[model samples]
Target: MPQKKLMLLGGLRYLLPVIEEAHKLGVYVITADYLPDNIAHKYSDEYCNVSIIDKDAVLRAARELKIDGILSHAVDPGVTAAAYVAEKMGLPFQCSYEAACILQDKSLFRKFLSEHGFNCPKAKGYTNVEDALEDVGFFNWPVIVKPVDSAGSKGVTKVTDKADLKSAIETALSASITKNCIIEDFLDKVGAQSSADIFTVDGKLVYPAYSDQLFDKNAANPYTPAIEIWPASMEQKFQDDLTAQLQRLFTLLGVKSGIYNVESRVCSDGKAYIMEVSPRGGGNRIAELQDMATGQSLIVGEIKKALGMPMDDITAPQYDGVWCNFILHSSEEGSLVSIEIDPEFKSKYVRDVGLIVKPGDHITPFKGANNSLGTLFLRFETREELDAAISNPDSWVHIKLK
Candidate 1:
């Protein structure tokens, strides 16, 4: 048989590891992006300069290359293109084009969740400010106004009073790509950021990881705070119950196989209010963290699932390692002075250090994941060590923004 070919959509920064993992597994990888400078572009077997949003362009390129399987692990914008190609070619894809559209559009996703009996915050989508403003009172204090078609918290605002609602909606809608946003009840009642990333083999739920989430609340509008932990601190029973609910979602959504990343807030009452679910791997180096914590790479799992391989080989994590990732961000948007990740900090537990910022480079406060300076991936023997390391960013590298 010929070597399996993997087609990836999006640039290299976030998608690089997926390419690296594919190459490590001896798969022929093709990366597609509109820009030639995309990080993954250099590493792939073939690089195609094509717009990710143009489904026809992506499908044409995939056909020309005769790709074996198509997948985009961490990038959200590329998921629909990947799905379109996969569906057109009869290739193994985790979701349908309709499903991808639903997930990408917050309004549609909320409706779908409601139809399936999942508890979602009351929300309304609007392209016109007047329409959204009409239902301002629907939400109690601390309402969340966010872009309908944005991710990583871009244009997301928490309005605690009516006076701020209109401004927040305008701000969110202005930043939205679709010129629309959904206003929803803000569930600020937090406990842990728990997520269940599950895989189903032949329609059977295999493994689910539900862990507490840590975020930096200070990040800008579109860029919600970044995550910092996995295999989160939570009761085992909570995980099991959450797993059951996720399995039902998978079944309801017709997600038989492939990777699914679902975000939620496990309230103090232990209820998992569904936040969002992406039919792709977690972004911001979470895939690498998952591998470090579980001994299974989501990149490889995605490839295997696409190739119709048995899922059992890479199903669960073997080690009880704590996985944490932090995005290097600036206090203000400007120019970079210096990013100093000390050389003396190398250890077995520290799996990877990626620094995308260079001295003298112009830097900006993160507007979204796009503005992030870099990322850090860590693996620890115990939770205590992980907590200590995460709490002390002083010991970690610092990027001086001028």
Candidate 2:
């Protein structure tokens, strides 16, 4: 049999490990995107210059390359395109083409959840600002306005007053490639929101792990997650309930054999609502952190399934210790000089501390996952210690810039 050929979308750093794993399995890898300068292209077996946002363009490139499988990880631009190509060419896929559309578009996803009896907030999509402004009164105060198709909090704004609604809509529409925006009620969170990674084999959920989302309220964009702790502080019963809800969702959508990074929240009403069900691996290295905490290979499983290989039973580990992954970023825009981590943080439990920007490199303030300078992965002996350190991170962690 000939080697399996995989065409990956976007050249982000997260694809680095996926490409390496494919190579180890003797699979041919082709990384495609308009930017050939992306780091992942340097490591891929081959690189194709095509814009991932243009579905037809990507499909054409995949056909010319004779790709056996098409998939994307940790990138939002290729989710729809991946499903489109796989469905058109008769390849194994995570979900149907129609379901992919619903998941990729925030407005469509909200409507789908509501129609399916999921506890989703009432939301609406718009193409123009005037229509959105006219219907602003439909929702109560404090709503979230965001691009219908973008991710990583790129164009998300929390609108409390009517005066800010129009500007928020314009911002969201500008971020959107389709010039679409969605508005929905912003739930009063019970505590921290949770983002987790779950995998399904043939539509059966096999492994599940949840993490408590940490936020930097002072960051440029306050909504973006700053730090995340594995084995979320949520009650076991609640976690189990969320897992069941996810199982129902994938089963309803006929999702099979792929990874999902799900965002959910227990609102002030004490009801769990599924916030977002991202069909691809999340951008913040959530899958990698999930693997480390749960002792399962989320990334490897995704790779195997994408190549149409057998999937072993991966169990969700009952984490005995806490793991933390900090989505490191700056709060100011300037050329980075260096990062200074205090000796207190250089513990033996520190797994890795990666900084993407070197001296003299321009670093943007935290707005989205794309603006992440790097990640800091560490393990703690106890949740108490983890809580203490994160509660007062300013005293130890410092970023130096000129």
Candidate 3:
């Protein structure tokens, strides 16, 4: 039999392992990105200079190359384009273009959640700044303003006052692909479920992943997720209940066979409200963490699912490990003086710790995930150790950015 040809939408940094795994399984890998310098572009059997969001161009390449399958994991924006090409090419990809459109649009997604009786924050979409400003007072104070179709928290803000509302709306709308954004009622008690990647091929009711988020109150000077730890610290029964509920929600939404990075927040009364669901792997190295926690690679599992292969051969482990991630965000903008991380601590359940900024590089306080300098990955035997290391950054190492 011929080796399967897998055409990946983006390049290596993340999708590399996905490509490597597929290649290891005797599948030919073809990668494409607008940037030829992308890390993954160099490693593929064939490379193309193409925009991932440009559906026609990607489809043309896939068809011309006679690709057996097309996939993307890290980039959420590329998922729809990949799905479009796969569906048009008569491949086994999940998610319809309409579904992708809806999921990509935060406003539309919130509407779907509301219609389905899921716990979702009150939100409304607006086409321009004026419309958003006029409708601002409809929701309570401390509204969340974010772009309708953007990721990595590129243009997200929370406004508790009228003066900041207009600016926040304009900022969010400026970053929107649709020239629109959503204004949501902010929940004071917030928590997010970073897991929701693994699921049964057809049922949509199977467990994917369930992770707890960690925030750095000092990074942005307010509060945002500086890290995320998975297999959540929640009670076993709570995890099971959440899984069952989320599975049912997915089944209701007709989702199947793909990895999803879902975000949700817990209300003051302990009700978990659905935030947004990306039909792709979680960002910030969470997928790798999920692998360590479950002993099953979520990306590989997704590939098996997309390929329609028998997945029962691989089983998720019961003994979960602690997976931790920390984002490096500067509190001020200046030249990178130095990062003093002890090399000896590399093996101390610290899976990976990388500082993307080097000496002489300019660093700025992070406004969002895109602005984050870098990330650190750690695997701990106990949660206590992980917490201690995260809480005491000085103990871990002094990150000195001038």
- Which candidate achieves the best TM-score against the true structure? 2
Q: TM-scores of the models, in the given order?
A: 0.91, 0.97, 0.91
Number of the predicted model whose lDDT against the real structure is largest: 2
User: Which model, 2 or 3, shows the larger TM-score?
Assistant: 2
How would the candidate models be sorted by TM-score, starting from the highest?
2, 3, 1
- Candidate 3 local lDDT, 343-399, one digit each (tens): 766667667755556789988887777667777777778878777887777776666
lDDT string for model 1 (1-402, tens) is: 788888888875777778777787788988888898877888888888898878899999989988888887777778888888888998888878887888878998898888888877778788888888788667665678888876666788878778888888898888887798998877764567665465656556675666566666565543355556776676666666667776777677676577877776666554667688787887676666677668666667788788666544546545566777777776587778887766655555567778887878887766677677877777777889778766777686766776
Model 2: worst 10 consecutive residues (lDDT sum): 311-320
Off by over 4 Å in 1: 221-223, 268-270, 309-312, 341-349
Error of 3 at 85 (Å): 1.4
Q: RMSDs, each prediction?
A: 2.4, 1.3, 2.4
Q: Which regions in candidate 2 have their CA more than 4 angstroms from the true location?
A: none
lDDT of each: 0.75, 0.86, 0.73
As a whole number from 0 to 100, the lDDT of residue 94 in candidate 1 is 81
| Per-prediction backbone clash count | 11, 0, 2
lDDT of 2 by residue, 1-402 (tens): 998999999998889878987898899999999999999999998999998988899888989988888888988889999999999888877898899999999999999889889888879999999999889779977899999988889999999889989899999999998999999998999878998778888888877767899889999999999988887888878788888888888888988888887889888877888898877888778877777776778888888888888866777656758999988888999988888778857765567876677889988899988899899887998989888888877766788776
- How far in Å is the alpha carbon of 194 misplaced in model 1? 2.7
